[model samples]
Target: MSYQLQDLLYLMQRLRSPEGGCPWDRAQNFASIVPHTLEEVYEVVDAIEREDWGHLKGELGDLFFQVIFYAQLAQEEGRFDFHDILDALVVKLLRRHPHVFPNAELYQSLEAAPPVSMEEVGQLWEAIKHTERAEEAPHQPTRHLADIPTSLPGLTRARKLQKRAAQVGFDWPDPSGVLDKIEEEIQELRAAIASGRQAEIQDEMGDLLFAQVNLCRHLKVDPEQALRSTNRKFERRFDFIEQQVQSAGGDWTRFSLQALDAWWRAAKEQEKKHE
Candidate 1:
């Protein structure tokens, strides 16, 4: 396993070599590789979602290559190398998993203790993370809402931001409260529409969406994943509508709203029949 990984690292180094490396590979900069890295990550997730082990192996290799690409770029700039990255990761893992490490302060008790619930493990993990954060930057100001990446998808970021706030007790007491907030936001959105102010409508729309994220958080659902699942369902249903329209000798653009509605209902009925 170590030999194979070392060979892959050597291959990456050769590809980035200025003398006779692949032109396109050598041309890539950190910024230029971001899109490919993101796409590869999504491909890996897609493989796991589909439970395609063979495809997953390939996708994971692609994802790993993204890490290698970044590490190579950093090495060229005299920042760090692949081993440095691995060292940091290993150090972090050992630091975080005190219960599993022999030299850990609580190792004896953790090893001798009876089985614990996953919730207990999670609380311990969070506590360790808090300690690590404080130790890593002792001079930095303590921040409850530590900087979450703005590059995250809006729904996912909102969930994370809300979760951070919830850690400090700034959240709805229950999912029922979140549902009520959603209803309130809906009314505000309707009023915005009635007022016919574009800015108000946009602001209200944002509020409604934010409320929806809060409800998802309270219900322990990932809003981004939920949205993606709905997107796939819509695609499937729309494809069924298109197939039906074509079977009936019609273009979708030429179909009436009533006709489309009928097709949509039929598609839904087909789904129920399958279920």
Candidate 2:
């Protein structure tokens, strides 16, 4: 580590110390820090999406500090510390990227392998991950579905599950097939709604979302990114509607659905014009 990073580590240790440390910093535990860590990750993603490089730098620092916080807590608990985290990452990186790190023991036999495309590199990465998971639980059978973290966002987890199944030739042939399945899922959801059984409806709704995520994967679109873009567009258009309603001397509820629809259309038109 650089001197600056070592200095930061020392600061973290001091802040987490029982004596003369900030009370809030000294009190946090792993579970308590999780929400802040997740928030920092989302903030970093937001900065990147907005193309705000200056804000991104700060967000990245915040995200890195979350790692440091976790490491500090682990050290207090007699678990691994920050250096162990870095060492494990180094090991994993060298083990996974055989094409780049052929001198490593994991890739010594593959040193003569042919040049690989990016797609092949991705396959190699997945294979290495699978091997690592198997090594982690040699007594139990490895299941790709079980390898995906439940903590991931719903859409991301859905995509990963679909991709893992697709690797074993379980996916639809193409986007058209996925679209057909999506329509079928919609019909099932409608049926569940008509049945008026809440549990059935929930199950069908989940299936619909999973099918939609499959369609997104087939179309080469990230469902999370696509939804976020749509969310931003909705917020922008709704803000325009609010402005128009105020100009007309009315509140949102005072405007009829037809009036709101007209405003929405106008907002969309204005957006198109700006584009």
Candidate 3:
């Protein structure tokens, strides 16, 4: 018989049980499992980006297991469990999609619901999210940027911060303005390098990267994905250079810069041919 979500939940419970439980699973806490959850997330992303459909199912299963593990931990602590998680998620989605669920009822017929423009839907989603954020912190002032997680990757976090600020009219008017800001940041970085103070240089470098992320946002590009693509390209070209060196029976130290440059040019040509 095919196993279902209930079976998966049972498996997690067994693994975390004190008696006859997997030692590694039993030892893990919320904080200890965070790294594995992050790795699983990236693996899922990698599989999708590579279009590895055969492995995508397995990667997604691994990511889902991380969620199950977290729920198991919370269940043991007398907190919410997997069912609660599902309930909250479904409720949130129904609440957010007012256009589809006009009566705010999940089981209600959608036949009579009015169609919504994509632009209006986007605005409505943001407005709902802002209201939810305010409700979450009713006693205190609502800081627009307060809810963004600090644990996000630098480029991803920078893009989110920029988007939040833009909602409040605190953003560059156009991509050209962002380009000018990037150029200004680069000049500041150059001056910092000339000063030779480590702290100043580091700060300037951060400013330069933040400006680049802003430029990417203004250009409708994902800075993280763009950098990942470049990284893969670099790896492919370097691998070609290594293969060329091995074919020539030459050591890396013996190869001059000019030889490596020629190999790099050859790699570019090969990539163009494939394209």
The candidate scoring highest on TM-score is: 3
Question: What lDDT tens digits, residue by residue, belong to model 3 across residues 113-224?
Answer: 5778997998899899999998988999989899899999999999999999998999999999988888998899999999999999999999999999999999989999
Q: For residues 74-188, write the lDDT of model 2, one tens digit per residue.
A: 8888999999999888888888877877776543544457779999999999998988889999999898788788999999999999999999899999899988998999999
Model 1: what TM-score?
0.91
In model 3, which range of ten residues has the least summed lDDT?
108-117
lDDT of each: 0.86, 0.91, 0.93
TM-score against truth, every candidate: 0.91, 0.93, 0.97
Clashes of each: 0, 0, 0
Tell me the alpha-carbon RMSD of every candidate: 2.6, 2.9, 1.1
Error of 3 at 202 (Å): 0.8
Q: Of the pair 1 and 3, which is ahead by TM-score?
A: 3
When 2 and 3 are scored with TM-score, the better candidate is 3
Candidate 1: lDDT over CA atoms?
0.86
Checking candidate 2 for backbone clashes, the offending pairs are none
lDDT of 1 by residue, 98-184 (tens): 657746443245456556688777777777777777877899986756767888888988998898888778999999999998899
Evaluated at residue 133, the lDDT of candidate 3 is 93
